[model samples]
Target: MKILIPLDGSAGSLHAVDYVASHRQLFGETPVILLLNVQWKVATGNVKLFINQDTINDYYREQGMLALQPARDVLDAAALPYQYHVSVGTPSDAIAQYACEQGVDQIVMCRQGQGGLQTFLLGSVVTKVLHLAECPVLLVK
Candidate 1:
């Protein structure tokens, strides 16, 4: 099975990684794992005018790598082999799109434990991903 884990550098996100790592045997032998980090696309038309495309791309790459670091460390400590990717866009959209393109079997993600008003107002990436992704999604809280 191919599992995609979307991380945002939060403790909540790392919980998902821990869940997967701890439940290794359930995934079978050598399951394909993907660690994906999506950086928010902040270089809009006005911002792009002041910065070159390469510079913006580099910023995204740097931020993406930083966000993936914790999850990577967790997987490494577990001695599991996995592939990782970085992309620039809305988090849910990027994750869903990548899962579709890669033909992933499932998406494992952390659920933000926000309050009622806050969760409703801010929305949740996991919620959007669940609606958008073609494959099954597992939430680790």
Candidate 2:
């Protein structure tokens, strides 16, 4: 089974990674694991013109890569094989979109992300993903 793990460098997100790593046997050989980090889109308007699109995208990609480090460590420690991806956009939407595009059978992720206030105001990322994902979603604590 292919599993998609959406990470945001939070303790909860790392818990999901540990959970998957601990239970790696359940997936058997060649189970595909995808680690994804989504960077928030920069607000639009006049400010965008001052920053080149390439530069903005590069910034996001760099941040996204950094955010994946913890999860990557967990996977590496367990000696598990996996692939990773980074995207720029709303976390929930990007995660769901990637899952669908990759034909992932399941999405294992944290119930909450790093942005507490934003999550409260915008609704939890998991909530949005659960509503939008075509596949099953398993939310870790």
The candidate that achieves the highest TM-score relative to the unseen native structure: 2
Writing each residue's lDDT as its tens digit, candidate 2 over 1-141 gives 999999987777888888889887876765699999988888477868699988888888889889998888889988888999998888889999999999999899977678668877888898889999999998777
**lDDT score of model 1?**
0.88
Could you report the Cα RMSD, in angstroms, for every candidate shown?
A: 2.2, 1.2
Error of 2 at 65 (Å): 0.7
CA lDDT of each prediction against the hidden true structure: 0.88, 0.87
Off by over 4 Å in 1: 113-122
Lowest-lDDT window of 10 residues in candidate 2? 22-31
lDDT of 1 by residue, 1-141 (tens): 999999887778888889999997888886789999988789987997899999999998998898899989999999999999999898889999999999999899888732368467758778889899999999988
